[model samples]
Target: MSIVERMKNLSEKECPVDILRKEIAGSKCSDCGKCVFGYEGVTQLQMMLGDITEKKGKGTDLALMKELCALMKTQSLCEDGEDVADAVSYALAHHAQEFEAHVAKKGCAAGVCKKFMTYHILAENCTGCGDCLDACEEDAIAGKKRFIHVIDQKECIQCGACMDACDEDAIVRAGAVKPRCPKKPVPCKRK
Candidate 1:
């Protein structure tokens, strides 16, 4: 197949949350305080991300995201908006562990999220079951049978597959090696 045939359309592939996030970020929010009480998922996510960026620690409130996304999915006027809600719902269902880590440890399993996570394996707890290795699509885990496994930080994408695979609960977030985003107050005035 040609590269053109294989290439997917950007709009068709864009994540709904990402679409809303981009729109929200590009605008100069008036801080009308409406979103805090509004029922829109995108707006809710916008408010949450804003609050998180403001260092308000609101990002830890995973429940709120779930609720807001639920509302959006059921009530949004447009499919685009509902897509954001569905994405959140999908994440909640399929990747609850990642969300729990964010709330409980301020870490992201997918290291793709800035300042959210840095994963490691606890050698003492690791039984070398090779579960993490099998789960790790990135090939980040390195170890032989009957020995402790080690995670290669450089190669790890923080996908958390290994964490789920580990029955021994040996995986842990070591904190960010280089924080992707600073947990600082939003650099804008809110009305």
Candidate 2:
């Protein structure tokens, strides 16, 4: 489905800004540079969207994007550019609050953006098998054998390798609200 369609049928897990950013990155509309409106407009959109997803968006970004999309809709040389412009316009018109949240440094409600997500090791599920510690290249996981591992949020890069390597399903990604976990490694309750 098109990005607009997906936005129209958005689920609780999907963020409109992130969805548009992914669509722009994956689409080839910006590959053609025959027209400045089509090429530079899409390029700017990509950069702006990237910044927004990374939590670096400015308060003025929405206004700037709207103006660019307007120009692309009318002046683009091809349908591809026009379609992308329409998708962005649709999202801006319908999901402006989502854009504002990211721009204002508020957490993503959908939790799809990596910059807004935090990885946590669930103490209840952790078996202290040491697999997660080995999988972590950042050394974010701290624990020894038979003890519940604790994740250092400052040191963590939010990579899912720890989650994948964990056979006990101890690691989880949290958004908005983080779970209560020990500040340091503790004895494992699960045997």
Candidate 3:
């Protein structure tokens, strides 16, 4: 399942009554991340979980995750975490480009990670139906009716609602690059 789908299911089943909600420690997480012999894998998982729970804006630490996966592949005690470690290793070995994109460009080729996605409107494809404007909660999309819309890269939260709303297939991905919009071309300077 996608992260958005998982989050939606959790929100629906776990949080039914919002009027009065109390702390419920359902699962016993011993906080002992000893499945992997090294602390790197579990530590990064904990950090990622914390960020997800807190709704942190930052993307995950890809370099750290990669290192942790490598460590866990050899150091893990049992099969519990070894499977994931092996999967990570497989991905690193075969899908290095995908990981590199996530780390270097902050973009997911699978389009599963929202934090690394930036929605862009294609002028040629966009019918300018104003669907994206209504879908965007961050007010990042701006354009007049019958005109091509533009996504304000800085203001976009990467929720992907705009992409979902567009029927003309105009909304596109630009691989969310922070501190610098990928839509703008940067001049290269030779050293």
C-alpha lDDT values of all predictions:
0.55, 0.88, 0.52
User: Clashing residue pairs in candidate 2, if any?
Assistant: none
Candidate 3 per-residue C-alpha lDDT over 1-191 given as tens digits, one digit per residue, 9 for 90 to 100: 32222222333223211100111111111244565443445555455434433234144454565577667667776553554445444434554554455445445544445566567776657666789999999988877667667788799987889999998887777643322223432222211
Residue-level lDDT for 41 in candidate 3: 59
lDDT of 2 by residue, 61-174 (tens): 999999999999999988878888999999999988889999998878888998888899999999889999999999988999989999988998887889999988888899
Q: Which of 1 and 3 is ahead in TM-score?
A: 3
RMSD of each: 17.0, 2.1, 12.4
Separately for all candidates shown, the number of backbone clashes (residues 3 or more apart, or on different chains) is 4, 0, 0
- Model 3 residue pairs with clashes: none
Top-down TM-score ranking: 2, 3, 1
Positional deviation of residue 107's Cα in model 2 after best superposition, in angstroms: 2.2
TM-score of each: 0.39, 0.88, 0.50
Error of 1 at 135 (Å): 40
Off by over 4 Å in 2: 1-6, 26-28
